[model samples]
Every structure is written in C-alpha cells, then in structure tokens.
Target: MNVALWIAAGLLAVVGLVGGALKVVTPKAKLAAMRGGEWTQGLSDGLIKGIGVLEVLAAFGFVLPRMLDIAPVMVPVTAVCWMALMVGATVTNQRVGQGKLAVATVMYLAIAAFVAVGRF
Candidate 1:
C-alpha cells in the first residue's frame, strides 16, 4: 500500500508540475486560442496564474514532508487540498459546459481522494 501510495503521489506530482508550469508560462492568448478562446472565459489571467502557483506548491507539499520524514501528515493534507481544488475545477468546467474537462477533473479528484485516504 505504501509503495502504491508513493507511486500515486509521484504521478500526481508529475502531472501537477507539468500542468502548473504550462499554465504559468503559457500566455493567456495562447491558452485561449487552444480552448476555442474559452479556457479563460470567466477567469482572469492573474487568477489562472495563481492557480498554477498553487498547483506547483501543492505538488511539493505532497512530496517534501513525506520524503524528509518530517510532518508526514502533510501528505494526506496535501492530497485533500488537491482533491478540493479538483472539485472546484470540475464545477467550473461544468458551469462552462466543458464536459470533457469536467470529466478529467473528476478523474483527478478521485485519484486525489484515493491517495488521501490511502495515505492517511
């Protein structure tokens, strides 16, 4: 179970890191262009970038304390946080009528919730 949790954490971290980095680095115009100009429909660029930063930090939160054997409780805490973020993201996508994005967010949310429970 521990090994499985670690693998899950690594997967989450990789996705979060890459997604967050892209969000941070990519221009709003580019993102908007990709998603039919609806990616940031109701969201400001600043808010989007902030979410990116949080994602990156959350990825670190999942790995750091556990890796250092310090405040290992933070692993589950981070997972919960990640799940909450995904829940919000899913809701937003649904509101925007982005069915595919909502589905993906739900998958991420489920994974995060599973990790949270398994790690805790």
Candidate 2:
C-alpha cells in the first residue's frame, strides 16, 4: 500500500506540475486553442491562473509533507483536494463537449480517491 501510494502520488504530482504550469504560463487564447482546452473559453484569466496555482500547490502537498515526515497528514488532505478539482474538471469538460476529457478526469478522480482512502 505504501509503495502504491508513492506511485500514485508521483503520477499526480507530474500531472499537476506539468498541467498547472501550462495553465499558468499559457495565454488564455493559446490555451483555448489547444486540444482538450476548450473549457478555458468560459473561464476568466484570473480564475484559470488561480486554479493553476492550486494545482501546483496540491502537487507539492502530495509529496513534500510525506517525504519530509512532517505533517504527513497533508498527503490525504491533498488527495481530497485533487478529487474536488477533478470533479470540477469533469463537469467543465462535459459542458464543453469534451466527453473524452471528462472521462479522463474521472480516472484522475479515481486515483485521488485511492490515495485518499489508502492514506487516510
């Protein structure tokens, strides 16, 4: 279970870091033009960037506390946060007619659910 949690955390951290960085740095128009990014069309730049920041923070939350053996409880808390984010992503993608993306978010949500239950 420990090893599984580590792997799950690593996967989510990579996804969060890469995806969040893309959201944070890319312009709204460019992001909207990208594949799987149509949902950006309905969101404000500030909201998008804020979500990006949250993702980056959640990435760190998954690893740092557990790695440093400080406040390790944060790992499950981070997983919960990720689950919430994935729920929103699923909804947004569905609304934008990105059914495949919505399905992908469901998978991420599952992983986060696993981490939450396993770690907690």
Candidate 3:
C-alpha cells in the first residue's frame, strides 16, 4: 500500500507538472483542444494565465513540500485542489458536449482521490 501510494503520488506529480507546463506554454492551443473545436473567444486571457500559474503552483505543491518534509500539508492540499479542478473540468466538458474530455477529467479526479486517500 505504501508502494502504491508512492507510485500514485509520483504519477500525479508528473502529470501535474507536465499539464501545468503545457497550460502555461500553450494556453490558446490547449484551450482550443479542450474545447473540442470550439473557439475560446471572449474568454479572458488573464483568466487562462491565472489557471496556468495555479496549476504549476499546485504541481509544485504535490511534490516539493513532501520531498523537503516542509509544509507537508501541501501535498494533500494539492490533491484536493486538483480533485476540485478535475470535477470542474468534468462538468464543463460535459456541458460543452465533449464526452472525451469529461471522461479524462473524471479519470484525473479519480487519480487525485486515490492519491489523497492513499497518502492520508
């Protein structure tokens, strides 16, 4: 169980890092992809950038604090935050009729939940 927890933690950390990097580097393109051919026009760039920054911060929260044994609470906090974000994503995608994205969001949320439970 400890091994499983560590593995899940590592996987989620890597995913958060990579996803955040992509969000920061290619917000427009990624948003487009997420929207499934729908234009993200009228959406505030600042909002997108904010989300990107948050994602990166959450990514760091998932790993750095735990590794340093400093502010270890951040790990669980990050998991919870990611879980919430995934839930939001799932709802948003479903409302937009993007079934695949919705499914992906659910998967992410599940992973986040698993990490949370395992760690706790």
Best by TM-score: 2
Q: Which parts of model 2 have CA positions greater than 4 angstroms off?
A: none
Backbone clash count, each prediction separately? 0, 0, 0
Top model by lDDT, which number?
A: 2
- Residue-by-residue lDDT tens digits, candidate 3, 31-120: 777646342444576766666677778778777887899988778778899998888778777776879978877887888898787666
- Whole-model alpha-carbon lDDT for candidate 2: 0.92
Q: In model 1, which runs have C-alpha deviations exceeding 4 angstroms?
A: none
User: What lDDT is reached at residue 110 by model 3?
Assistant: 86
lDDT-best of 1 and 3: 1
- What lDDT score is found at residue 79 in candidate 1? 94
Ranking by lDDT: 2, 1, 3
Clashing pairs in 1: none
lDDT: worst 10-residue window of model 1: 33-42
